[model samples]
Target: MNREPLVSVIVAVYNQERFIGRCLRSLLHQTLSSEKYEIIVIDDASTDRTSYALELFHDAIRPVANARNLGLAASVNRGIDVARGSYIVRVDSDDYVNANFLHMLSIFLEMNGYVDAVACDYLLVDDGENVIERVDCSERPIACGIMFRKEQLIDIGLYDESFRCHEDRDLRIRFDKKYRVYRLELPLYRYRRHDSNITNNAEAMRQHEANLIRKHGLDLAASNGMS
Candidate 1:
């Protein structure tokens, strides 16, 4: 018999053949014990060798292949549906994290009874792994580097599948309203910025941002931070 995993790390991928291997490798190398965490990789109907790359880690990761491309939010939701852990963390396939990422975040959550979630500082890197800038996440933190209590997120309805964009901000809005998300100053995550990033679709993102504002019924002033 095996012990239940303490954390479920969800990695959502979409045609990330070039980076998925490195991402999975980084995860496999986490300082956290293998038995302590479960890696759930949701492949969003990749057309490239992303699936093949993931297959290489068959023993380490539980792969979920989408029949069709359901996009990021839906893919994440799918992973959450099957996740079996006390805590949940989201990491994009194109991005990778430091070895101590899980140990730091998980221990913090376990110790801080008041904090519902925790996020960490991240380095914004290009495809070449060159540092673009360091996002201390001084203001609004990103959804990827944060770890949330599984029950808390499930109670809040997980990721909004309807939101193809601004899903993180939408969840944060509702999450912050009920629970607190603490920021760890340590740079434990490496956020990769590339042309394929969905944020590059300005028009689509703007439309989604509008939809998000409408959904929450916020004024223009408050809408600026929608993403």
Candidate 2:
């Protein structure tokens, strides 16, 4: 009988042909045993060669392709829906991670059952993968490199489909209300910064920021003791 994997690594991709290969390769090279974790890649209707890039790893990953473009939040939610692991982690298709990324994070969670979720520090890199800065996940969190207990995520409700941007922030706000996300303090993830990054779109980010603020305004104010 096949035992279920301990961790499920979700990667959502859209028009990331140029970097998806490297991202998938990094995941395949993890120190964690292959049977211990499963990689789920959701291709969000990429019009580029991203499909071909994903095809190279056809046997190694569980691939899901959307018929139409559903954006990041929806794609991630879909991946979660199909995941069969006890724990979940998201890794953007354009970014990569160190060989120990999964082994370290999963081991921490395995030993610390009380923790609902755990995040690790990451190295920010340019398009060329040069180290720019080592970011503190607790102080400045990004969407990925965080591993959450699957049940905790489901109990809190998954990513909001309404959010085209700042989806991570929206989910984090809701998740933090009930459970705490502990930090690992190790730079195991690599975040790639490039012009095509969604955050670079000031207008979209501004709009989503407003939506997020409105959705959680009361909670935010109370946390800040303004209420």
TM-score of each: 0.95, 0.96
When summed lDDT is taken over every stretch of 10 residues in candidate 1, the lowest stretch is: 218-227
The parts of candidate 1 lying over 4 Å away from their true place are: 219-227
Candidate 2 Cα lDDT to native = 0.92
Model 1's alpha-carbon lDDT is 0.88
> What would the per-residue lDDT of candidate 2 be over residues 1-227, giving only the tens digit for each residue?
79999999999999999999999999999999999999999999999999999999999999999999999999999999999999999999999999999999999999998888999999999999999999988888889999999999999899999999888888888888899999998999999999999989989987887787788995572352200
Model 2 poorest 10 in a row by lDDT: 218-227
lDDT of each: 0.88, 0.92
Compared with the true structure, what per-residue lDDT tens digits does model 1 show for residues 1-227?
A: 99889999999998889999889898889888889999999999999898888889999999998999998999999998999989999998899999999999999999988889999999989999888888876464676989999999988888898989888888887887788888899988999988988889999988988888888867642633722
The collision pairs in model 1 are: none
Model 2 clash pairs are none
